[model samples]
Target chain A: METILAQLLNGLDKGGAYALIALGLTLVFGTLGVVNFAHGALFMLGAFCAVAFRQFITYETVTLDPTKLSPWGAPLEIKTPMAQIWFGDFGAVLINWSVPISILLAIPVMLVIGIAMERGLIKHFYKRAHMDQILVTFGLAIVLQEVVKAIFGANPISQPMPVELRGSADIGAMLGLTPGMVTYPIWRLIYFLFSASIIGAVFAFLRLTTFGMVVRAGMADRETVGILGINIDRRFTIMFGLAAVVAGLAGVMYTPLVPPNYHLGMDFLVLSFVVVVVGGMGSLPGAVAAGFLLGILQSFASMTEIKAIIPGIDQIIIYLVAVVILLVRPRGLLGRRGVMET
Target chain B: MNIFYLPRRDAITLAVFALVVLTMPIWLVPFGAAYPGLMQKFAIFAIFAVGYNVLFGLTGYLSFGHAAFLGVGSYTAVWTFKLMTMNVIPAMIFAVIVSGLFALAIGFVSLRRSGIYFSILTLAFAQMCYNLAYSVLTPITNGETALQLTINDPRVLDLMFSERGAGLPSPSLLGQGMSGIEAFYVVAVVLLIAFYIAQKIFVSPFGMMLRAIKSNQTRMHYTGFNTRPYALTAFVISGMYAGLAGSLLAATDPLAGAERMQWTASGEVVLMTILGGVGTLIGPVIGAWLIKYFENIFSGFNDAMLHHTFSWLPQGAQDVVVAITSKFVGEGWQLSLGLIFVLVVVFLPGGVMEGIRRFSSIFRNRREPGPTGALKTSPAE
Candidate 1:
């Protein structure tokens, strides 16, 4: 029971990430009818946002301390973090919280990127074949990752969680079970809660807001929405920005779980794409549900009990599920009729 | 195979292609690719790209898992080498049969859907194969260490024919050993045969059916033509082509690894096909050669070479020149590839073939000075 509960927690945080990335992908597909392969690059950029922010806060100034000579007889150099010099203890706090705080930087930066991508490159491809769209965006993704590689090198850069939230929490004790029985990292739990809110916020925005209704209508019938004189193009572009922001935020939160590497986007993008297909192409709710479903199934498959029966089940369960779902349920779990099938 | 009554233009094109391929070791010297290893790769991957183009260009089915078939072929060939003989003939035939079966099963399932779903399904299936080969099937695949030729126990055919040799035997054609330029010639001959077969398919009525399916599957369905079988056949054929390519890889270098089945390899074929003109006969081959050349030769260019090339410039100017050009070559070549791929897709959607066509059309128009002559004989001609 403890093991099962712990795995469920593990699944939830992973599912949160899958759900977040898939959400953005589905949104872009829904609104633009364009498959954005560069979405994973956006996620990687978000993680880099955290990395960049940390570097900014940890920027140090050095001064030679002539009074304090080292054993080697050279004057000692004192290096102080720029944040510390500017804000004292607050600067130290800023560095500690840089990962979470990077969200502020990621949003606008990712939005501009998303909008620019849509306007500059993707706009030209809208009339082209889906393969062309995929190819061009694939090229864009390579360029983006390569650019990151050039800047940060190919190695993964780890992001540090805040000092307070770094340790695992004994959730089982709080839930009235044995203490420390179902321990999970504090940040993971926070990430799950954070993603849940983001998903909710997106849902509410689309369900309740006037602008979102228009976007939804645009998704349903682009020609009809355009005929309605709403200038749905502008709103759809913003939705693309929203999708980028969502993917970025997911990356921002996920950096501590896995270090950000140049190829992180490609790896995650492929899985998220599988997640999208399993959920049904362009189906928002289906993306979320499938994300969690695959995540949990994957978690369960990785269990020693499961592994004993079927070796390497965990390595391929997600892909296997995707294949079966794609074959058995062509439109996916909640997919509407004739969406991307033709 | 029925290309015996080849069209006038196609025959000439094939003749030229054959001449170019046969004399590659000599002609490619100027490009610094004259050496046998890179030349062999050029022929091998040209076969891969050409085979890939049959299904992708003709049927418009973008299979993302074609490398799985290639991997199956490689493994089958290597297993043949382990169990039967070091002869490439049996290996090639066995590899084709196994990978064709593999493709049949996968294509049967994946062809149920079209568009993005098809791509995703193929990708998923390939990833599954990679995962299985990497872990669960490690006994057969040798996992991460990879499967290579050995001289331990069985070489049933070679043993039947002759006594055991002192060292491990290399892959051979008949009684003679194949390596270096000889191996390249063998690959080149196979590529020529594959190219001829691809051209035959392109002109065949079956090819017309596949093209019709690509253009309008719905209309074909409405006309009561079940297009799935045609698509499946193309898929299987391409799978066989990929398998052949894989066996050739094993023949050239007796090793099979799970990395061969990875989707990135599959992506590389797609890039090759697209980088050349899609749907064009020689486009994919050119694309394959260009990409392999870039990957092998261009990537070998380092800052030292760049500095030497720019030795005439002043010190500061040379440094700046080298710095700028260095990113587009060597380890940073992928950056250039990505940028170039993007530019090509955006501007020259038809690929290098289209660019070539457009460039020639300018001269043709300048000579003829009218649209009538250009229209009758395709600017492509």
Candidate 2:
């Protein structure tokens, strides 16, 4: 029973990440009909943003002291608040808190990147066939991955969690169950809450706002939306940026969990795509449900008992789920008619 | 003689082309660097590309999962080798039949959708296959490590034991797999001829119907022609060709891995089809050669090689030049490929074949007087 609960939590966290990325992809695809293959790259860029911000906050210039015994010592230093809290033991207060500071820094940077990508590359591809658009975006994704690799090098960067959220919380103890085996990471819980809030906010914005209505209208019928005296193109472009922001923010929060790498995008891209497909293509709610569902399935598939029967079932669970879902419902779980039909 | 009147010109060009291909390995014998193994790789990929062209180029159906068929073919051939005698012919035949069956099942469902959805469905299926082969079907696929014969395993047809040794001898016709430049040359020549025959099929009446279906399926449906069978036939035929290529791959390498069915591998064939010029006979072959060239030769370059070659230049100049050129080769080859895709889609939609045709047309136009006079004074006329 405890094992099952633990697996369920794991599933939720994994599903949260999947939903975030798939939500972003579906948003762009839904609003613009442009299959943004670079959506994964955008998420990758967000994690890189965190890495860059972390580097900046902790940056120190060393000067060679020829006149003194100590060589390669920094003459002056500045420290961040969290840095002091975390690295007070080493007497390096300022830069020690880089990870927490990176969150604030990731948002604006990711937003700007989202806007730039939408305006610069994706804008040109909106009018082409979905395949052509997919090709271009896929190309853009390769370019982005290569560029990131060139800048960061082909290595996974380690990120220490915030000092406050460093340890595991004994949920089993709280429940008065066994003393161990059900400890959950505080950071993971925080990540799930953060994702849920973002998802809720996005849904609210789309449901209650006028801009959301216009975007929904655009998604329904671009020709009719245009005929109604609205520049649906500009709106769609903004939606693309909005989608990128969601994916980027997901990456930012996710960095602490997985520690981002250049090729990480490709690793998640396939699974996220399956999530999108299984969720009923353009349906936002469906994407979330599918993400969590597949995540749980994946968790269950990784059980020792399951592995004994069928090795590598965990790796193939989501794909098999996607194939089954697609065969049964060609339009997907919540997919409307005429979406993927011939 | 007028160019339009010279249908025989194509035949002559084909014969010359066949001669040149057949003679290439012999010519390369003096160089010794261009081995038969490399030539065989080129032929195998070319065959795969040609099969891809059947569904994509002729029928306007861009399948993003053709590599799955290739994988199926390879696995089937390897299993056949394990079960039956090490006859290359039978393996190739089994590959085709098995791959055809697989395609029939996949195509029946996937073909329900068209355009981007169709591409995605195929891609999704391929990814599923890749994942399954890597994990769930590890007993059959042999997992990340390729399947190989064990000493205890029975050879069903041969009634002989593979000598209990550290490593088993390669399964091939007579004894060992094809060796030296001569074997590769033979394979390449055979494939080239087969490609030519396939090309003839592309221009045949049946090929024309496939083209018609591509242009307007609904019209054909209304006209009482069962378009489904035609499409299915094309899919099966292409799958068979892919299987043949896969069997050849197994024949040469003697192992099948899940990586062969990757989405990127499927995408590579699509890139080849588009790059070479879709619907044209020679395009896929040319595209295959170009991509394989990039994959092998271009990616082989490293920073050390670059530094050594440009040592005489000033450090900054060398760095700048190397940085720019490296995208075309080395680790950044995919970037170059992506750029090529963008440029091709945006500008030369007809691909490399179209460019070659245009270049040839200019020369032909210069030599001929005018269309009216040229036709009136045709050699036949």
Candidate 3:
């Protein structure tokens, strides 16, 4: 029971990430009707945004201190972060909370990026074949990754979590069970809640608002929505920006768990594409459900006892599920008929 | 117009192409890439790209997992070397058959879906193969360090030929050791044969069916023609081509690494095909050669080399040029490749072949008297 609970927690935490990335992917696919292979690059760019913010806020000034001489008899240089000099204790606190603070930086940055990407390159490919879209976007993805690599180098850069949430929380004890039985990371719990809220916010935006209704209508039938005299293209472009922001936020929050690297986008891109496929293309709710399902399935597959029977199943569980889901339900779990059927 | 008949113009082009390929070691020296190993890779990857074009160019099925077949071929060839003689022939044959079977299984399942779904399925299957090769099937794959020749392996035919205590023998054709230039020639000959087969397929009725499938699958289906078998056959044949390339890689290098099965490698073939011009016989080969050249020669350029090349310029100008051009070469080759890919896809949908045709047609038009004469010399011709 303890093991199951722990795995479930792990699965949910992972599922939150998968769900967030897949949601953005599905949104772009649903609205633009172009398979954005660069979606993962956006996620990666978000993580880098966090890293950049942290670096920017913590910019240091070096001064020579005569009292602290080095072994070579030269004056030792004392470096003080510029934020600390400017804001004192608040600077330290801000640095500690940089991951959360990065959301502000990421939103505008990602929106501009998403809009530029849509208007500049993907706009031309709207009438082209899906293969062409995929290839061009893939090229764009490679360029984005390489640009990141050029700036930050190829190594994974770790982003620190807030000091208060450094350790695991005893969920089992809180729930009146054994104290250490279901201890989970506080940050992970926070991430899950955050993802849930984002998902909810997106849903509410689409369901309740008139703008979102029109967007939804556009997703169903672009020509019909256009016939209704709605500038669905502009709305769709904004939705693309929204999708980028979502992916960016997911990446910003995820940096504390997995270190940001140049290749992180490509890695997640493949899995997220699988998630989108398993959930059915252009199906938002299906993407979220499939993400969690695959995450949990992958978590379960990774258990030692299970892996003992089916060696390497953990590595391939997501892809295996995708294959199975695709074979069994070609339209996916909640996919509407005729969506990407041709 | 006969399918089997070689048109006089095409025959001349083929002869010229063959001559260029055969004399690559000599001609490529001026480009600072005369090394036999590099020349062999050019031929090998050209075969791989040509094979990929059969499915992607003809049928418009963007398979993102073809590298799995390549890996299968390489592993099979290596295993053949381990168990049997160090003869390239039997190893190549075994590699093709094994990879062909693997392709058949993967293609059968993946072909059930079309468009993005088909691509995702193929990608998933390839990733599964990669994970299996990397971890679960490490015993077969020899994991991480790459599968290479072992000293204690059972070489039944090898034992029959040479004495028991000789060092690991190089892959040979009959009795002649295929090393250095000989290996390049061997690969070049096989490449020519592969190109010949691809050309035949391109002109064949089967190729037309594939093109039809690409243009409109629904129309073909409604007309009583089964498209599934045609797609599967194309997939298998291409898989065999990839397999042959893989075996040739092993035959030249005598090692098989799991990295060969990576999706990025599969993507590389796709890039090669698209960069050259899809659905055109010569485009893929040109793209393959260009890519391989960029990877090998262009990537070797560094700041020092750049500075040396541009020494006549002022120091400030040299520095500026070096700084700018440096990003497109060396470790930054992929960035340049990405930019080129985007630019090509955006501007020239038909690839470099289209660019050449357009350029030549512009000259042809200028040479002609008026609009009527220009019209007489159609662009297609």
Standalone chain B TM-score for every prediction: 0.94, 0.87, 0.93
Report the C-alpha lDDT of model 3 over A67-133, residue by residue, as the tens digit. 8898899999888887788999998999989999999999999999999999898999887777778
Tens-digit lDDT track of model 2 for A69-111: 5334644333343434455555253344556566677777777
As for TM-score, the candidate ahead, 1 or 3, is: 3
TM-scores of the models, in the order given: 0.95, 0.86, 0.95
Residue-by-residue lDDT tens digits, candidate 2, B1-381? 442232465577577767766776676466442666667877888889888888877677778899999999999988887888666778888998999999998888777676666777788778888888987788899989987666545556665554444555455666545656645764676587568667666767778888877777777878899877887788888888898899888888778999999987888888887788777778888888788767766678888888888889999999998877765668777767777876765556567887776678797876543222100110000
Candidate 3's residue-wise lDDT over B1-381, tens digit each? 565576576677678889989999889988988998899999999999999999988888889999999999999999998999889999999999999999999999999888888899999999999989999999999889899997888889888877766677678888778788999999999998898888778777899998888877888888999999999999999999999999999999899999999988989998899899888889999999999999998789898999999999999999999998888788888899989999988888778887887778798876543222110111110
Candidate 3: CAPRI quality band: medium
Interface RMSD values for all candidates: 6.2, 10.0, 7.0
Off by over 4 Å in 3: A70-74, B1-9, B366-381
- Ten residues in a row with the worst lDDT in model 1 chain B? B372-381
Residue by residue across B48-70, what tens digits does model 1's lDDT show?
A: 99999998888788888999999
User: How high is the lDDT of residue B21 in model 3?
Assistant: 96
Q: Please identify which of the two predictions, 2 or 3, would achieve the higher DockQ against the true structure.
A: 3
Local lDDT at B312 for model 3: 97
Candidate 1's TM-score? 0.95
lDDT of 2 at A266: 74
Ranking by DockQ: 3, 1, 2
Considering summed lDDT, which 10 consecutive residues are worst modelled in model 3 chain A? A333-342
lDDT, candidate 1, A240-293, per-residue tens: 999999999999999999999988998888899999998988899999998888
